[model samples]
Target: MSDKKDPSVWQGFKAFLMRGNVVDLAVAVVVGAAFTNIVNAVVKGMISPVIGAIGTKNLDHYDSCLSATCQGDQGIQIMWGSVLGATLQFLITAAVVYFLMVLPMAKFLARQEARKKAREGTEAAVELTELEVLKEIRDELVARRRSEYGER
Candidate 1:
């Protein structure tokens, strides 16, 4: 048999942990966790209270009894208010992320792209003019050389 040894598990684990994507994922997870708290707070504190002013303060308490014996958890109860609250939270989070982050980033990127295109346009015009001048000079030199040579 050959004398080559297999790599240890620790080396494999270390390589996995040292990967750039893994580090980025770890940072994203941490930031997501922190962001979750903020979103939850906004949903619970602001949205929930405003909605609760029209009904029960706790969305979990709002449910419909589908069966006749719904008293004391004895029948089928549809917790529609909880679902509505969850949906509202999702919408609010989406709107916040969109309006605050995504929209602004898109606008900034568009502005940057426009500036880049403008620069490229200006540079292209200058380059085209420079090329035309070089071609003119070449043609003029060739014409002068041909006239001198032809005359000789």
Candidate 2:
């Protein structure tokens, strides 16, 4: 009988976890949770107050009653202000993450890629020059051999 054991499910799972993308995803989730707190704080502390200056301080309280005998929680209410506040929070978070993190990283990666391409191009140019010189030397040697053989 062969000595090798079949691959187990647990081994495959472990391999998946060890991949770079899985680790990066785990880090991204943790950072995103932390970033959420900052964005929520900014929306609540700064942006909400600015909106409050116009009317109500608490957006949750700013709702419209749709029923005729509407009082307190006894009505079909449209909570547009809460929706607006949530939308604002989402927009601010997206803008900050894009401008502060994604955009700068993209530019930096682009610069690194450009530098890599330039180095490769320089190496290729040097290799091409060397090839041309070798070809010239080979042609000169062939011509000299032909002339000697013709004279003989």
Candidate 3:
């Protein structure tokens, strides 16, 4: 029998979980879910009141009646308030995500890349300096060797 052994499914699954993208996505999902509550609260407790000043206090209360009498199927009522509430929620969520998580992370990554590039440039400069020093030492050695041989 061959001594080689194939990787188990568990090992493969573990590797998948360890990948950067997978871990980042998992973390984003958890944070996003948690952030959802804050967005909802902001829209409900803050924005809704401002909107209420202009219109109805609650979006659920804003509806249109299709029939002459809107009493339990006597007339058809189009509940547009719920749609407005959903739209408001969506906007709040998008704004919070962009400002808090995405923007800061992008700026941080840009800073890290800049630092890495600067370090690489410094390393290159040091290598060039080392090369110049070595060349100068080699030239001095050749000069000494030639002078001694000429005297002999």
lDDT for each candidate structure: 0.88, 0.91, 0.89
Model 3: lDDT equals 0.89
Which ten-residue region of model 3 has the weakest summed lDDT?
1-10
Model 2 lDDT tens row, 1-152: 13343356667888999999999999999999999999999988998888899987778878788888668778798998899888998999999999999999999999999999999999999999999999999999999999999999
Give the number of the best model, judged by TM-score. 2
Give a tens-digit lDDT track for model 3, residues 1-152: 23333456667888999999999999989988888888888888998899899997799988999888998767899999999999989987888778987899999999999999999999999999999999999999999999999999
- Tell me how far the alpha carbon of residue 50 in candidate 2 is from the true structure, in angstroms, after superposition: 0.9
List RMSD in Å for every model shown: 2.9, 3.1, 4.5
Deviation (Å) of 49 in candidate 3: 1.5
Scored against the true structure, residue 66 in model 3 reaches a CA lDDT of: 86
Model 1, runs deviating above 4 Å: 1-22
Q: Is candidate 1 or candidate 3 better by TM-score?
A: 1
- Poorest stretch of ten by lDDT in candidate 2: 1-10
Between prediction 2 and prediction 3, which has the larger TM-score? 2
lDDT by residue (tens digit), candidate 1, 57-143: 778888898998788858999999889888887888789888987999999999999999999999999999999999999999999
The RMSD (Cα, Å) of candidate 3 is: 4.5
